[model samples]
Target: MEFDMVAAALRQDAADVATYARVLTVTLADVLPPGSVTVEYERSLGDRLKGREGHPSRIVVRLGERTLSLTGGHRPVAEVHHEVRGVVLSRDQVSLDVWVQALARELVAQAEADARAAEALRRLVTGA
Candidate 1:
């Protein structure tokens, strides 16, 4: 993920919106599975502007039966929500925490996989 890309996407000016959208599209392409990421932006509502005063943006990622959503504006609390239906799961906060932990574990697993692949390639080149 590029800091410039994220920074650009978080910019405030109208002229910057296209640049930001391009950056966001590229960034999402890098992290998201094929055909799984959706990005959208909308003008600030009057009520929202009374307190926040900026455009609202959203990024949604769908992975089979699970969906992860992230929404943000010029506000402090950027909302994040996740839902996993079609599975036997508890409808409680504990389940939500468990899902969060599972996602973290999956990220760690991917990192480990990348490390192992890199080591193997290094060993092959060095004949180690």
Candidate 2:
């Protein structure tokens, strides 16, 4: 599914589009097959010493020949990088809304063909 499709679904299902998109990104990362999505954490020395798992700072999703990379902090802005095959297509600073929407769209597209992904999305949207 494209971002537009995901947006339409969210408009119909979610009370808050931005929050749902962010949650969907995390859900996709957790549920997708290993090696399909990679998450990076920004752990401080104190966190490492305490054996605490830091929050995700970066997520990279690879679908077929395209890759979408999102890097974010505590702010509502994120750095997004997209590549097709091995060529860089776009790299820009986008709002958190834009970032999560892109990620959700990729997950929706994956769900269209993958049962596991579809199940995850269904469960998420229905809260079942």
Candidate 3:
């Protein structure tokens, strides 16, 4: 988890969104509990034609039965899926900036309470 890199990518306008998404997924997967997050990879048509390896294309984070997913690309948006009663509900087109800020805040809160999380976050912010 390159914590400093993730923060830089999120802040810099010229940063690659795909790379940001990938790094974010990796860091969250490390800090969060196991099996809570998953990532999918795919090659674009051009990449496939050129025989390049697939890149991370989707990331999903599950909290109980509800899930939040984001697509990795030039412009990323978040979608939330959950069930109520017997019906499945979905909220689409959530702003990526808002979603990330919420996650960042949650991570900070967790860091404040847990020594391990604090260390992970410390590494993330300081790149140590």
**Per-candidate TM-score against the hidden true structure:** 0.35, 0.65, 0.62
Q: Which stretches of candidate 1 lie over 4 Å from their true place?
A: 1-25, 28-31, 43-56, 76-128
Q: What is the lDDT of residue 109 in candidate 1?
A: 37
Q: What is the lDDT of residue 73 in candidate 3?
A: 67
- Measured on C-alpha atoms, candidate 2 has an lDDT of 0.61
Whole-model Cα lDDT of every candidate shown, in order:
0.40, 0.61, 0.60
Candidate topping TM-score: 2
Clashes of each: 0, 1, 1
Give the true-structure RMSD of model 3. Answer: 5.1
Cα RMSD for candidates in order: 11.5, 4.7, 5.1
Misplaced by over 4 Å in model 2 are 1-26, 29-31
- Tens digit per residue, CA lDDT, model 1, 5-97: 222323321223333334335532333346765666665687466775344366554554445444444432122344456452332223323
Instruction: Give the per-residue lDDT of model 2 (tens digit) for 42-127.
Output: 78899999998666666666666556555554453455666777787877777656655765676677787787777777766665
Q: For model 3, name the residue pairs that clash.
A: 3-124
Q: In candidate 1, what residue range of length 10 has the lowest lDDT sum?
A: 5-14
Worst 10 residues of 2 by lDDT: 12-21
lDDT ranking, high to low? 2, 3, 1
